[model samples]
Target: MGAGFSRRAFLQAALPASSALAFFSTSFRRDSLISAATSTKPQKVIVVGAGLAGLIAAFELMQSGHDVTLLEARMRPGGRIHTMRDQFSDGLYAEAGAYDFTDAYVLLCQRCFLPSR
Candidate 1:
C-alpha cells in the first residue's frame, strides 16, 4: 500500500514532462474551469508499471506540472523491493531475487521514500 501511494505521488510530481504539451494546450482550453486569461493548464498522463524507474520518471514528469496516473500489472507494488520477512525470524530480512541498491538508488530513496505509517 505504501509503495502504491509513493508511486502515485511520484507520478503526480513528474506529470508535466511526461505528457504531450501540444495536446494539453489544445484540449485543456476547452475546460470551463480555466479562463481565457489562463493560457495553459496541466497535462494528463498515464504511467505503466510502478517500479523505481517508472515511479521516478512519473515523478519527474509530474513535478513539471502535469496530472499523472500509475498502472501496475501486479497485485502489490514495490516491484523488486518485495520481501520474505515472514519466512524469516525476527531481525531477519531477505530479498527474493534482489540484492542491495546503488548510489542512484540511495539518492532516490532519500528523495522519494514513503513516510512511515
Candidate 2:
C-alpha cells in the first residue's frame, strides 16, 4: 500500500498484465490466442438501451464480429446524458443529466475510443 494506491488502480493494471502473461507465456501461441479471442461464427446480439454502458457493450460486441442491435426508448441516444438547448429566453443551454465525469471515467473513455499506438 502506497500514498496514492487504491484497489481500482491495482486491479486495472493487474488485470491486463495477468491476461498478457497468460497469453504470452510459453504454453500459449500468439496466433492461437488471437484466433481464440475472435469469433469463428458471428452471432446476433441485442443490447437494451443506448446509454453509456449499453453503447460500450454494443461497440465491443460489434468489434468482436457480432451483429449488435441497440434499442433505446428515448428519442435519441445517451440515455441520461442529455443537454437542453435553446429552451431559455437568452439562448442558454443546460445539462439535464451527467454533466460531469471523474478522472477514472475520462481514462476509461480514452481507453475505449483512442487508437492504440
Candidate 3:
C-alpha cells in the first residue's frame, strides 16, 4: 500500500485473476488465432482493364506476393493509343488519342500502359 511497494508482490497477488480473465475472454476465438498463424498461398487478383491505372495496381499487388492478371476491354491493349494517317494526306500520320509514353513512364508503360508489343 506504500509508495515503495514491490512490483513482484503486486504481480504475485494479481496473476491468478488476470489468467482467469484471459481464460474466460470468449471473444478471443481459438480458430482465429490458428488461421492467423497458418501459412497460406498468396492472394489471387485480376485487373479489369489493362489501362495505365489498372496496370500499376496489378504491378504493386504482384510484387507483394499476389498473383495478378490484366484484362483488356478491346481486342488489343493500349487503352488510348489511336494512331491513324491523315484523311487527305497519306504520308502524314497522327495520334487520335492517348498521350505518348516517355522514358519517365517506361516501367509503367511496360507493366501497365502498353500491351505485349
Candidate 4:
C-alpha cells in the first residue's frame, strides 16, 4: 500500500494493462478458431453477466466468428470480484468475493491466464 494508492486508481490502471496482456498473450490465437471451424454459419449469442466465466465464454464465441453480446448488472465486469482498500490497519487491503480458485478450475485458469512455457 502506497501513500496515494487508492482502489479506484489501482483498478483503473490495472484494467487496461491486464486487457493489453490478454490481447497480446500467445494463447489468444485468433486464427486458431478459424482454422478449426467446420465452415458453419456464424451465430449470434447473448451472454449474461460479465464475470470471469461470462467474459471468457463471450470472448471464445467471438473468436469463433459468433456475434456476442455481454450483459452485466454491475457497473463493472467482475461480478463479485473486487478489492477493498483503506478498510484495515496500516494500509492493508481486502479482496472481496470469489477470490479462490479450486483445483478443478486450475487448468482452465492457467490456460486462460498463463503463457505456455
What is the TM-score ranking, best to worst?
2, 4, 1, 3
TM-score of each: 0.46, 0.51, 0.42, 0.50
Give stretches of model 3 more than 4 Å off: 1-41, 85-91, 99-117
TM-score of predicted model 1? Answer: 0.46
Best by TM-score: 2
- Candidate 4 residue runs with Cα over 4 Å from true position: 1-40, 99-117
Scored against the true structure, residue 89 in model 1 reaches a CA lDDT of 88
Query: Tell me, what's the RMSD of every candidate?
Result: 13.8, 12.4, 22.5, 14.9
Write one digit per residue (lDDT tens) for candidate 3, span 1-117. Answer: 568878888889889997897578545664453354344567777887766556655666676667888899788665666567656486787866655553325765565557634
The TM-score that candidate 2 achieves is 0.51
lDDT per residue for candidate 2 within 1-117, as digits (tens), equals 587998889989989997987467647653464365474678888998887756765766677798889999898998898888877767688878775554434544787786322
Error of 1 at 17 (Å): 22
- lDDT tens digits, residues 1-117, model 4? 488998899989989997997568546554554465426778888998897767766766786788889999888887788777777888788888885664324544666787323
Worst 10 residues of 4 by lDDT: 99-108
Cα lDDT tens digits, model 1, 19-71, are 76535644553334224323456778898888765676476567657688989
- How many pairs of residues in model 3 come into backbone collision? 0
